[model samples]
Target: MTTVGFLYPGHFAEDEFPRMEVILDTTIRLVVNRTEPGEDDRRPDTLRTLGEPERLAAGVEELRRAGVESVVWASTGGSFVYGWEGAHGQTTALARAAGLPASSASLGFVQAVRALGAARVAVAATYPEEIARLFSEFLAAAGIDVVATHSGGVTTAAEAAAWGPDRLKELAVAADRPEADAVLLPDTALHTTAHICDLEELLAKPVLTANQVTVFEALRLARRRTWAPQLGTLFAAREAPPAPVGWRPAGE
Candidate 1:
């Protein structure tokens, strides 16, 4: 079995990892270690602390004991708020601290978008407009264009975690534009694994959710491939061989 570790921030939506493991039913093992909760706001400063190398490093021993082959910092806002270069450095630092391959949700989205051969996408974010815009900027740096964006104005992970299927579908439908290649939901706090296929079907396009790509990235780092149609188009598509050990997606 390929064991991947997830260093998740706070308590919200980490359950999605185990839920995914159950759905995937593959040799891939998802082991999550929760980092201490920080201020719930999405401000740049707050997010910087949330994704701090020290905070991520503090959780390394738990994952190491779990025998994880790779580690992922599974918080989209925390990572993207750092900007592209900083986010790359964040993963590098985490990998060094964990003594294992490391990636984060923001980077995962970029790789997932490229893997789907999509250049343009629509963002459906639960963060406020400003924070959501940062994600758009981050994607642009990676050569992905944001055709449209819809922000939910949710201020905290607690609020986002409370969002149910109806709200998620509404946000995705509102965010999608005909010109976009796929719709992205970039909040790890949002519960989405059980609804990925439904969201894609509803939009008639690929729906790349934060937790989904996070897991996909962890698997990529572990040099493992899986076929899980239930997880939506990213997982259903035949993936190429895992990139080399130190591979960073194009703009890193």
Candidate 2:
């Protein structure tokens, strides 16, 4: 079995990892290590602290012991709040600390967008508009265009975790634009594994959720793929292409 480690920020929605293990092919397994919950706020300052190198390093020992082939910082807000360059540095430091291939949910979204050959996407974010705008900027830096964005104005991870499938579908539908090739839900705190297929069908296009892309990125780093149609289009594909040469976050 191939194992992908995730350094999740808190208790919220970490259960999605285990749920994915059950839904995905038996050859792939997920090991999640919850890091310190610095604060529940989604503000940029709080998120920067949540994704700091020290906190990510503190969780590496557990994933290392689990024998994970790759590690990912699984919090979308935590990583994206730092901007593209800072997010790259975050994963680079985590890789050095864990001695394994490393990535984050923010970078995963960019990779997933490219993997699908999508140039423009719409964002359904659970963060406030200011923070959601930062995610758009991050995507822009990575060459993905954000055609539309619908911020849910939810300020805390705990609140976002409480959202259900109906709410998720509404957010996606509201954010989708005809020009966008796909819709992206960029909050790992939101539970989406169970509703990926449903959302994609509702939008009539590819729907990439934070937890889904996070796992995809980890597997890409490990040079592995699992056939899990229930996980959405990203996992249903035959294979995930390796990041392009000189990609800012090179795989180990």
For each candidate, what is the lDDT?
Answer: 0.89, 0.88
> Following a full C-alpha superposition, what root-mean-square deviation does model 2 have from the true structure?
5.6
**Estimated TM-score per prediction?**
0.94, 0.94
Q: What is the lDDT of residue 225 in candidate 1?
A: 82
Q: Which parts of model 1 have CA positions greater than 4 angstroms off? A: 240-252
Estimate, for each residue in 1-252, the C-alpha lDDT of model 1 and write its tens digit: 889999888899999999999878578789998999788887878988898888899999999999999999999988998999999999999999999999999999998988887768999998899999999999999999899989999999999999999999999999999878789999999999988888877877788999999999998888888888788878875664242233222212
Give Cα distance to truth, residue 17, candidate 2, Å: 0.7
Tens digit per residue, CA lDDT, model 2, 121-153 = 999998999999999999999988899989999
- Candidate 1 at residue 22, lDDT? 89
